[model samples]
Target: MEDTTQYFDKYEENLQREILKMCSSLGMLDGELLASEDIDFKWKEWAPEYIAVALPEVNNYPDFAIACAGYAGMAAAHWWDEDWGRHHSAEFDSLLGPRGFDDMDEHIVQKILGLTLDSVEAKQIMNILLCCAQKASTFIRHEQIEHQTVKAFHIFARTVKVMFRTGAALELKRLGYKFQKVDLNRQLPS
Candidate 1:
């Protein structure tokens, strides 16, 4: 039988490969690419601060993979907020298209939870969740009185909580610890 760590390690590696490929395809793989387009406009100035805060929390992991996942989420939220939906892409319209930021908060949470991701799949799902967390946090910090941003902040907080719990569960399972799927809705008691 394959060791659990091997499974997690392989899963992490595969996720990284996919992230790299997706970023490359979007022309967002590095600093140079960041300068090549309008994508940077949507990235919050507070993103780096959020990333700095997140990095220490995942310090024990090799390559700080958790932080990377969080960063991916932050980036994806910026893109989705600025680039996706009917306003940005005509072909991408859906009934759930950005229906104000408050509705969008619920949408983001639903999107994250609905992923039903395996460890290998978590690479992408976790990234999007973390990104949403960071973006929402930025809005909350900067625009404290905005109702939509506040609601979004709460939703994104749940997202961060869920993402961390999910990652921990995967790691624990990899370490040969038995884990049951904790209802993510109840993952944050209170």
Candidate 2:
């Protein structure tokens, strides 16, 4: 039997491959996201949430994966709102197709939690879950494994969470959302 770490490691590697592929397909360099004096995005903020959603004991794995992905989408939206130039960029719509996917992370969660989509406020929520879900579908798939067990699903859940995070980061990059360092000391007037 393959060690659990080894098993999940494969998923991690493939995920990185896909992420790089996504960046290339979108004509964006992965280097732009690397740390520098100007970058200010703190990815560690989502760690606690990831632990809850991915590591929780669950009765259903697919649902777990879906829920984890949704959480990721919503978290990504939070970061999206931090910038002044948020909606000005057309990257997400162009890449994800059409419109309505701008805040899809939140939309998907709203949808799964039984929120009504008929309200005037929800009119923009439709037709978005699938596109983002599709982006993560490949990561959650479990074909190569010889046996489909609860263990595999758990890994899938973790994979789903990570893939969604990565996708969001890529989208944010494409949308021109960079984390600019805010040096409080520098901003203080003498």
Candidate 3:
């Protein structure tokens, strides 16, 4: 992935910064890199790449591919981890519609994530997420204007959040890290 952030306008950059801030506010950025520290601008670069890999056969399917990945990520999180409980935002649920949340424990999404990561390293995954973010940013902007809602924005946030966590888990699996089920209340600090 090349340095794609150079192509992002001031609003786009600010949007990315807002995401990092959201992560921090939600306690999701405990040990993760801040947006400013993204010196290589990997986040936005990987967003489109993720779309490509998700729907390679479709020539112009970025939106569909992104929605698919986002839905899959949401489903996979619950399937992969017993303690993984999403806050279940009503707005996000409405945006995804009835069919999207119907297949939370499905195998197809898991397979997609596995296949997507099968040929990549950590840096590659980071790039993929960044690129995915870029596409999501565009989708959010367009949807916001066309529909006058922020559901598109939440979709981007929740999707990227899941993707980042899933990517980290996949990388740890690649590094021979063992995953053990734990009680959330009984967890120890890293």
Candidate 4:
């Protein structure tokens, strides 16, 4: 019988081959193709800070890759905030409304959530959640002031959590990883 370690090694080899095959089929495994995309947005967003703390030995990863990693880290941080922070605070309610917050733009929501309305899947979900949040926050502030409802708070929290998770996924996809579901609870701050 084969040893357990040998089985594990064979499994790993098979996984690597499958991943390489998929990458090749998608035309993403080629170094030239990787180099061709304008990952300048990611690089500009992440390079300086990474360079500041990078270890000398592993400095060869492309700027875009480092930027993508940094974005993933930031998304993790934001998820923590959504999970633990008092997302339904009076201040937050006051900032969302039919008239909208004086300083808030719908676009600001996209920027905060790191989403764009251009993609069909992302656009549909984001539009629904953002509109719901805006309306719910407004209702809480203007209509529900007499009594705070668990239902309202639940809606608020769910919306915020979705926004954070969606943002994280977008950033990860931008970095070229096939996004799996983010485990939000695992990211909650201790």
Best by TM-score: 2
Residue 139's C-alpha lDDT in candidate 4?
34
* TM-score of every prediction relative to native: 0.26, 0.44, 0.28, 0.24
RMSD of each: 20.0, 10.6, 14.8, 21.0
Measured by TM-score, how close is model 2 to the native structure?
Answer: 0.44
Over the stretch 58-167, how does candidate 2's per-residue lDDT look in tens digits? 33443333434433443354345455255223232221212233334444435422345565423322223243345445565544543357766656555554445554
The CA-based lDDT of model 3 is what? 0.40
Which of the numbered candidates is closest to the native, going by highest lDDT? 2
Question: Of the pair 2 and 4, which is ahead by TM-score?
Answer: 2
Q: Could you tell me which 10 consecutive residues in candidate 3 have the lowest summed lDDT?
A: 34-43
lDDT against true structure, model 4 = 0.35
Number of the candidate with higher TM-score, 2 or 3: 2
The TM-score that candidate 3 achieves is 0.28
The true-versus-predicted C-alpha distance at residue 57 of model 2, in Å, is 15
lDDT of 4 by residue, 1-190 (tens): 3574464445434433433343345443331112211232333343344333322212242222222232322234333334424321212222222543322223333443455557664454344334333432443354342333544433333323323333343333435555246877686676
lDDT of model 2, residue 122: 35
What is the Å distance of residue 107 in model 1 from its true position? 12
Kindly report which residue stretches of model 1 are placed more than 4 angstroms away from their true locations once superposed.
1-38, 44-46, 62-110, 119-190
Worst lDDT window (10 residues) for model 1?
Answer: 31-40
| Tens digit per residue, CA lDDT, model 3, 1-190 | 1343342343345544554454445433432432221211233443444433443422354444443443444333333342323422212232233354333213233432333334444234434445545556564555444332344333444445444444343333333445346888886879
